[model samples]
Target: MLLSALLGVCLIPAHSKPAGEQLGSPLLQTCFEEAKKIVDDAYKYSREESLRRVRKEVVRPHDALRLLKQPRGGTRSAVRSADYMAQTLRLLQERVHHVHKRSLNVTDLLSEEDLNKLSEITGCASQVTFPSCRTTPNLNTYRTANSVCNNIKNPRLGSSNTPFARWLPAEYDDAISQPKGWDRTRRFNNFLLPTGYDVRQVSNNILSTTDAGVVNDREYTHMVTMFGQWNDHDLTFTPFSPSIRSFSNGINCDESCEKIEPCIPIPIPPGDPRLPTGRNSCIPAFRSAPVCGSGYSAFNFGGEPKKREQINALTAFLD
Candidate 1:
């Protein structure tokens, strides 16, 4: 189950599938087996279990999304997640043992074999799948005049998914796992900005601001996030809320294509409480078909033109 979730290589069990389509990627299989061997050796040889987890952004998702092809199953079980965590810890502990065995500490160099294997595995992203975001949002510097902003509050009352991020967790003291109070907001320019990113400073008499790259950043960026696991982490999915408009004073929904070209009287409601002075029975509801939005580069790369709801979905994801 763990292997299946992480990489959908084995659609059916080994026995069920024929010889030609027997196993998953050889690299993947070797990785799991090697990881398991290291763990087993650690337990047998009384090795150090100084294992730690570092938060990291990975490129493996590109391949996982490509290989999975379709949704096999949605993740919903805590038991499954916990089990995977245990397995990962074991792998980490094995690495600790390996370090001790080779007398390799912080300054030590890994054998050439390890580096080559890592490079090969990580470079597995194929152009065939997950090409890129077509409608990539433009990133630009914030300007007070343009009313460009980030860190705006969501008007509808609801708690942010992560309280530690918003200072809601007063008792949060895990400095090692969580960001230091001062460092939380201070993104290291070298780290957050991509490689080869040039920096420029913009300022006024009072204070200076950074405008390293682009002109007008998108109001929000929406990427389709998916989770499967041999390894994964917690992610909060924030959906967007769309604005609802109320039209009045010569806005004819009943007569336009919004409702129908040749509009007719539709039942508003029997004796509506908000009826104006001297109104007859029911009036036109002015119901309209949802005319989807236009094609934009924001559509997922290498796919059909994006419709209105897809745009909304991206907005919702960002929201």
Candidate 2:
């Protein structure tokens, strides 16, 4: 996530209105506008440098193609030409990954603002209000597209289980054919799952699918870049690296709601379809989806308000 000036200190205004009024105020609108500006600036800074490098790397393939176009010169075969193309593609892939990673870091921060606005926009509650961000599908476009899909259906498909059956592929094709629809689709799926499936389901089905187009390749590469950048940033921020042995007894995660009411440890089934099976699945049992805060319909990661004291103390180095 892009570091923000609003962070580490509360900016609710000392004379902040009641949560109800604040919910309706244009503050969130302004927040999103500001966040978007930040994201655009970040992109502008990174995109030029990145694209230049990419074009340079791609020149290898271009040169190989040019060489192949000429008469084989009777001296040497064009075997090395194909090899050059392959290497160029590989390098271009890396360049895409590197560029996309930097871009997504900007997005992670933008998502934090998006989540905050979700409450104000959608009026959904139970959304956590922390400066955290995660990239996923844009719900506005999803809802609109899904609505259009609902209107069109495949007559031949008896069961709705077929992946294509759920979507108005032909209609979507028509829609995406239009400039507006294509732009929307690109924004909606900037981090889109290939095969036009739901973004959440992509993780579940990536192994099953074989079509690894540039889009899918870029998505995976960008995701790794974002995750890696986050890891590095998180380490820098929370550098107090205590070994597990420091908590040999157990983690004293404070005595608040859990200590007072006790955390309800609901047992989940081991073989639930929700979980990953087999030996290599190092999956967690549960995860939460984003929701709106109090007013907006925008998605929030988790609804917990940031603990100012904790964040400030952790970020004291800024002083």
Candidate 3:
């Protein structure tokens, strides 16, 4: 009886089909083709717009330092690669949303194999694959600036411009790609989460320091604070989205207060002490750059796109 039961489990009809064979179904094939076209058009527009911004530049002394601090060489390439993957994944999600009748997480509907096929279609499979790490004599003596090849067995481990490892699984609002607190109406644990602006107001009211409230600490100097910030930067630096405009609607993030992809503007609450409170008056913010092959689904196939994760521009380890 036991042997038969084990055999029954192995012979299950659902499990019999070859992996990713479902993508060949007419519905999925149509969705994939439509999604591909959308991705191609949007990606081209974004790339052209970004280039236009870069070419028309006015670099002052203050801007010089900021520009110098921007990602360079491999790091810059990693960011661009991530942007492509993110754009592809988000558009795919939108396609899936429209095709499915009932509300469901895209991850639930799509398998690892399905996502892999989609990535291949979008040319994202090449971007997510790990590069061959070339060993060097200097690697043994000193850490590479980007932290590549730091580990003999795992070359990309703790590397700069790589995704930060998650201690726990990510918890997106949509359980797939949407960021936390993305849906204003969505409730978690029977409680609505506060808006980013509301949280900022609370911080100002409770944590702001006045001249009388300031207290000097003789044990530590300003160097301590500077060093702390420097050390923090060494460990992690999450770059924001390179595009200043939305890919979906082409709305300038700096001008729009609407919470959209790339733009999560912090609205100033009414009766704020410092900043003005109005519909258009809000602090502009951009979403962090996601790792290629992350923030798409729950399943990961050989470094394929999974849940969204922010890229760390520096080594996570002490260098």
Candidate 4:
């Protein structure tokens, strides 16, 4: 259990993503050794082994303090590494208590097959090995190379925004890309605006042909980025924040809606065919208000009517 849990702390294959981090430190090595004896055949079922080895190795409060105060505190990576170490240590101790109460046998805790496989992968020389073809029957990589999604740690410490550039390309990117024609009349609208960025960069911006809207409401919205880097508009001109930038008359939202400053309602009357088929009751678009708007932008990419028209179409999208 300790071995599996320890490996889980940072067990992504080296080839998957380049995180040259050592999850366990030299000081923590003794902890693993002591834990090993508790589950080993020599010390099985011995309460003395459980007390001297398990409790002394991982459960002690002083050991946690020692690991947390490692000299590598200056760097952010060091801090995160220390955190993972502390969390895993706490987990290990909790497992020890649970196991001690249950009095489960070592073999009972982990099957012999799982134990051996773990051993082969994390070899004695402190190296990890890729499973062979026979070892990984489920992985069919002959025609297509297997790819696993992972988060590669950013060695850059203190830079909070991009601290860890996440990666889920293997699963999500492919899935999103597969629906090629879905964007046109895909039946859903989205605005993705990210936060904690240089806010000043988007001031006095216009969004037209090359412009895109970002919408985030923590509900019924999306947190977007300029995935394609549309250069036509400045986001802050619209007073972009990490929140919703709805159509307003600069003074009042309701007053603006009355005049159609930037908004117009979708005409989805009762019995309208476009109102989702098979619904017993009539339902209009959007929960914010029974209104839609001409999503005008100061940053028109190419020309006035063309860019304005595009924004209107985007605003009209129901989803």
Candidate 5:
């Protein structure tokens, strides 16, 4: 069933417009052209900075905290490499997002080819696209650290830094990249989703433990919870965006309560036990880093608009 679903997704037509068709508004074309230059410059700078850091770390071993902290194994190295790539992709996404927002109306009119061109300009096409897996002598003997090339036929399946396989199609507020619940006015099934703070309050009311109601389990200890967490870490890890600042605006996520891209602050309700009851007192949070080229509607094989899907930093399969 899963294979069939995956194949179905893979087989969806690109739905590209005719080659002679007009791209879009002049403003949209201009935005994309400017974006291309910005993306190219950003990649060049990132590459140069990376090389400089490598050289510095190699020459001054004492300053190599990042290298020293890394575990001495192929798995750790592979995971670190994935982390670097994810970070780079996140930055690229931020840059493109900024450009898109500058002319949102025009951007919304962009076709699949326009988005594909943007992806290529940003170097995300190379990052998200899977490479051909080469079988090794030890292929069956050991599992990879990042779980890449695990399936000889499908190298990226179940791999770290890949998009989660969705059983159902994603539903976004914009029917494209914006997250569900992003717009408070947005409705699902004739009902509105409650705010995060309201849900927290309900949890506090029902799940909070009192001294009088403290119950002990005979069969299990705290180690069960600890082990569960450890096991869970091995299976999936969705990392938050590394930046604390919003991509759309320069506002620091910690200081702003706005539902800007990357910052999704939890508003505190009135008469809360701990937190203050104001917009400014909300808990700060960041959106998870997205899989490169996955969120945009234009990039997917399936012509349906794709919502932002978080990257699974660990293997989907048990490691």
Candidate 6:
């Protein structure tokens, strides 16, 4: 009984035959004819509506009115859309219908050679089928970044797909593999050239101090970390907050923090939330530092009280 039941299940038909092949069934033929008629009418109405709008826009006022007034197909001046009429006739052709039905039997899209070529281009290790590799959003970027990240030695410097791959190109992956001279730090400008952006314009736009090429250590660190996070990691995927303290001489300097460090502390007026308020408030703290003089001189913080000369020097700089 079990063997008989299994045979019966295997013998069952999965798909039905086309309407044309079922001519013996009168009911099926009648239903198919009705469906074809409905489709024809829908196609006709859409064409007619589109042609009517185009006719209104293209013809002169008098000619349009004459065409509208005349009966269709009489040659007096009937409104006819040649493009739509031609399309409708072609679709309704017997040969086109036969070709459409035959084309549906095709399932496989890629040939063996095409498959091999794609695999070679992508460097995919295992054999992959076309259907399985259907294009998905951000797949290209992820693939490129993944390949590049695999070859890189330094885990921190290497670009990752941890967050998301935006518009990553194959070149970026290939470039990352190439040796970039003695410097280990990944500089995007050195390896990857930015498209659409003017390099000189970008450099000029960045606010630089009088010591043009020299940047404080904190700024340098910040710039490196920021580039690694933005370009390499794809900013969207990075988990950390963007706010970075790029100065060593921050208010929390409790230990022996007297030595010269990067990041010039810009003294804002009192009540600015950036400065810490002690027993004397932020005003006294800001006032303590000797005012900067004309030109870009180093900030003077000698153990001297606020002097009249120092205040005048700052005022002159401001002017």
Which candidate has the top score in lDDT?
3
Q: Each prediction's Cα lDDT score?
A: 0.25, 0.27, 0.61, 0.25, 0.55, 0.26
Off by over 4 Å in 3: 1-70, 96-100, 104-127, 133-143, 167-170, 297-307
Stretches of model 1 off by over 4 angstroms after superposition = 1-31, 34-92, 98-131, 135-174, 178-319
TM-score of 2: 0.21
RMSD of each: 27.4, 25.1, 9.7, 27.4, 11.3, 33.0
Q: List the residue pairs that clash in candidate 1.
A: 134-297, 135-297, 135-298, 139-217, 140-217, 239-316, 240-316
Native-referenced Cα lDDT, model 5: 0.55
- Candidate 5 Cα deviation (angstroms), residue 299: 3.2
Question: Per-residue alpha-carbon lDDT of model 3 for 1-319, expressed as tens digits?
Answer: 0121122111123333343333222333444444444444544564575455555665334233333455666666666555554554454456454455445445545655666665565445554566666646577788776667778788878877777787998888877567778898888998988876776688788998889998889798899999999889779887765555676676877678877877777778887887778878877667876666666532434443356777788788766
lDDT per residue (tens digit) for residues 1-319 in model 4 = 3343343222233343222222233213334433333223221222243245334635644234323322221122222222222222333334433435543322223334543432332221111112233443343433212111111132212121111222432221113211222123333235433321112223313332232465446754322445323321321011101101122212221122121211221222333323332322222111111000101111111112111111100111111
Compared to the true structure, candidate 5 yields what TM-score? Answer: 0.64
Question: How many backbone clashes are present in model 2?
Answer: 19
Judging by lDDT, tell me the better candidate of 1 and 3: 3
Best candidate (score: TM-score):
3
Give the TM-scores of the predictions, in the order they appear: 0.19, 0.21, 0.70, 0.15, 0.64, 0.15
Task: Quote the RMSD, in angstroms, for model 2.
Answer: 25.1
TM-score of 3: 0.70
Q: Which is better, 1 or 6, measured by TM-score?
A: 1
Off by over 4 Å in 6: 1-113, 120-122, 125-197, 212-319
